[model samples]
Target: MDQEKVNEFLGRFVADLAATEAAGSVVIGQRLGLYRALAEGPATPEEFAERTGCHRRYLTEWLRGQAAGGYVAYEPKTGRFSLTEEQAYCLADPNGPNLPAAFLIALGMLRAEPRITEAFRTGEGFGWHEHHEDVFVGCDAFFRPGYAAELIPHWIPALDGVDEKLTAGGRVADLGCGLGSSSLLLAEAYPRVTVAGSDYHADSIALARKKAAEAGLSDRVSFEVATAQTFTGTGYDLVTMFDCLHDMGDPLAAARRVREALAPDGTWLLVEPNASDTVEENFNPVGRLYYSGSTFLCVPNALSQPGGYALGAQAGEAAMRELIAEAGFSRFRRAAETPFNVVYEVRL
Candidate 1:
């Protein structure tokens, strides 16, 4: 091996491991509400401990790590730690983008690394429901903000006539609606419509139901335990699959089921992980995350059922159009997109 290249890779490995450790610290801070406490204002370890009821020594070390990691701001003169506006948005503010939720999901995957390795070697696969509850919780927290920021205002409006239909009154199904974030969002946004959130994980459905009841949308928004291919419904004016199509073992069948479930003039709004159509086009940070997430999580879930097509989290717009077309959706087009996701509109 070339000594220079070896050293280069060694540095990269250490950097990656450090980032992983930082992610672990992020999870801890999220779980303990340290970021929320700090968001209130600058504080020394003792003051922060008082704010959060955590031990000061442990809090001091964590703050130092966070400061070194550049996640929190530190002052040499005041000897205090705090969050900048941007950092507070990403970490402490739940109404904004809760990116730490993604890190929490990564932490859940780390716990299943051993089983995932065995599955890789043995040609066995795991399902989404097979993972720890942390995965579900993280997913809900991570995706909910984006849904809140865009679902009705941006995504639904982009689809022709769908918004008007939902506004007037309609039946909607939100497939794979983890924790009812999207489902509840729709029900809250469109009072005239009824939203049914469905997922195969019973635990997630239970939580979604609880959330609906908590939101006092129990009558307008309901959650059921079902998969993409097994959700039983008909005459749905609109159907939504949010960031979950690539995780289906049989996306084609799921697409067909949605088609059959929709009214003849209904719209199917499908959201997926954003990716370029070609492999070489996806050589970026987002691609890296999606590829890693696919190998460790998404592909395994897709493979858990028959076919094991393993479309993966990086399957791009081209792949999605084909899937929709195969299900007899003649009209397909790009609806809207963020750096992290792609939205598509499909209709008969």
Candidate 2:
């Protein structure tokens, strides 16, 4: 290889390794409220310790690392660290993107590296319930913000006649509704509709029910422990799968189930990670992130179940359209899109 090209590849490798090291530090900062404290104002390590009651030496190291990673702004002259407005939005504001929490999901999956490696060798499957609790919690935390921002005002309205149907006292089934975040958002938005959310993981369903109770929406939103293919429901005016269809081993079966569950004029709202049909076309930063998640989480979950189709996170719209058509759905249209998700409206 050319020496310059080798050196460039080495630089990229080093940057990636550094990012991997920083992932744990990001999780720690989130757990200890370090970013939020720093967002309050610029502070020396000792001042940070005083505000958060954390040890000074550890705070100093974390702050320095964060500053070096461009996650925080460092002031050498002032001997303090702070978050920029963008940093605060991504790291400190829980209602904003809360980008740091995404690392927790990565860390959680990494904890199962040995098991995943063996799966690679044996072609065995690792189920979702088998992963660390951080995976579940981190997933909810990471996706909730996007749902909060877009689900009501944008995604719902984008669906043809679904928003009006919901407003007029319709029924909804939210499949793969982890922790009920999307389900709760829908119930909170449309007072007339009742939402039935289901997930295969019992723990996630339990937590979802608890969250529904906490939101005082227990009456309007209900959760059940059931897989997408086996969920019990019928005559739903709207059926929603939020960033989850690709994870199912039998997504076609799940799609057929959704078709059966919906009313005659019902709409199925499918949300998946945005991607192109060609591999080279999805070689950008977002695709890189999703491909990693697919390898570590989504594909493994799919393989662990019956059918084991493994339609990864970047399976793209063409593949999804084919699956919908095979499931006996006659109409499929792209409804809306965000940087991270592609929403489809399906009908019979």
CA RMSD, predictions in order: 1.3, 0.8
User: Would you estimate the TM-scores of all the predictions?
Assistant: 0.97, 0.99
- Report lDDT (CA) for all predictions: 0.91, 0.93
- Summed backbone clashes in each candidate are 0, 0
For model 1, the run of ten residues with the poorest summed lDDT: 301-310
What is the number of residue pairs that collide in model 2? 0
TM-score of 2: 0.99
Those runs of model 1 whose alpha carbons end farther than 4 Å from true positions after fitting are 1-7
What tens-digit string does per-residue lDDT give for candidate 1 at 78-146?
Answer: 999999999998999978788889999998977899989999898888988889888999999998998
